[model samples]
Target: MVIKLTQPPKEPKELGVEEFPRLGIIGGSGLYDPGIFENAVEVQIHTPYGLPSDNVIIGRVSGRVVAFLPRHGRGHKYPPHKIPYRANIYALYTLGVRSIIAVSAVGSLRPDYAPGDFVVPDQFVDMTKSREYTFYDGPRTCHISIGLEPFTQEIRKVLVEVASRYNRTHDGGCYICIEGPRFSTKAESRIWREVFGCDIIGMTLVPEINLARELGMCYGLIALVTDYDVLVPHQPVTAEAVEKMMTEKIDIIKRVIAEAVPRIPAEIPKCGDVLKYACV
Candidate 1:
């Protein structure tokens, strides 16, 4: 069942400023619990958008304060299209999280980007049809520019360095985000691979990335390649196969996060000031 907070809990006044989590990790499919967090506390946050997918888990990783949120809730109850992307990002923002590392399982579009590999996507193409893609929906509209690069380079550099030490890691790639509770058709998958030159495909990146940018928070993705998206002449991608692959490779993913957390710089250069020029 989807978890929602009927009454928002007040932030504890006893907690010091240093205790606020600076790093946020949004866990994707099969990643309900971030097994690496220590001294974890579940904080139910209520955002202007609504309840986040689940309670934000505040914990320590590598002795640094970090927050973990499961994108699909504890039981994977929310579909990609139905995910509360706005609320999720907003909830993290309220917790003083300045940088976010989004961990997701994706289907590889190219043959070389094989299964059980890790990719740090520098770019993303949003093909999602229906979802909340932004935060400034009303009178106070802000035109957030994501022109140069969508993902945070500061975080990307750290993730690339840390992930390479563990497994087969692609330094950079293009992620195509589609609206889905369903996998791609063969024809559509081929076009994304051949025509669009997309390296990876997944469902829930759009609004999450956009909202983070709007909030001026540094955001980066560490995509775990789960299966070939039907373009390769192998078994057609299935939910079962994706889950199996994520299960096998979760250890490697966790290791990357554990190592990368401590290395991410506290002040990511231009990411925090993104809204300065964005608001008209």
Candidate 2:
């Protein structure tokens, strides 16, 4: 069977009375609630890739137009590998969201980066397998260079500045994104920490950020530290413990985002123009 690919619209039509959001928020794990937004409204979007993780909640944050998507869906229905990442990102792109702030819980690999701290990662090592990582894979093709940095520096600067004001925040770190619904084995965790020097580990950052780059959208991650991965000798992590930490730090994530949103530049990132010279 052959499926048709939808050409991206030059500009998305306004949905109902809502203006298209220029900024997007993708909430992960226990961060699904869009209560941080004012005058929020649920928007059901159909993308060429498929349905988004959930109905996108479009609203205003600090007088900025923003759209929020719960990465795991409400009630935490989807696991990391099961997330419709391409669709989630494409939906946001179609809705005219040129910049995205991806928020997710992560396991810390470094002692200095303790649980409850926040990190704005500068680089990501993709350790994920079996996920669609791009939009230019078939009938059309483009080779976009991610180079040494994948996350948007402009977005990261705002997140770092805001997070530093009220919480423990790291300006930069390397995020090793693993494919998992399960925690890494102790040996696997050790290899990641000792051999690769990964500062944090998580399951969802792969195709989500990669695909954003493919579409020329500015993407940034605000990592919430939920546990010390099994690599830490005495700090064994559990689902309950991770949940507890996420609960405690979720507000901090919200605060950082609230402060960062209004400060993001209205223009899209300079690197987001991948199609102009990337395609042969």
Best prediction by TM-score: 1
The CA root-mean-square deviation of candidate 1, after full C-alpha superposition on the true structure, stands at 2.6
Instruction: List candidate 2 segments past 4 Å from native.
Output: 1-13
Give per-model CA RMSD: 2.6, 3.9
Worst 10 residues of 1 by lDDT: 8-17
lDDT of 1 by residue, 162-240 (tens): 9989889998899999998889998899899889989999998888999999988999999999899897665788899
Q: What is the overall TM-score of model 1 with all chains considered together?
A: 0.94
What C-alpha lDDT, on a 0 to 100 scale, does residue 276 get in candidate 1? 88
How do the predictions measure up, each by TM-score? 0.94, 0.93
Per-residue CA lDDT of model 2 for 1-280, tens digit only, reads 1112244434434443246788999998889985788767677767877888888877789987788999999998888999999999998888778899999899998889999899999987888889988888777778888866688888899999999998889999999999998889998888888899889999999889888888889889999898899857788878788889888888888888899999988886485676578886
Q: What is the number of backbone collisions in each predicted candidate, taken in the order shown?
A: 0, 0
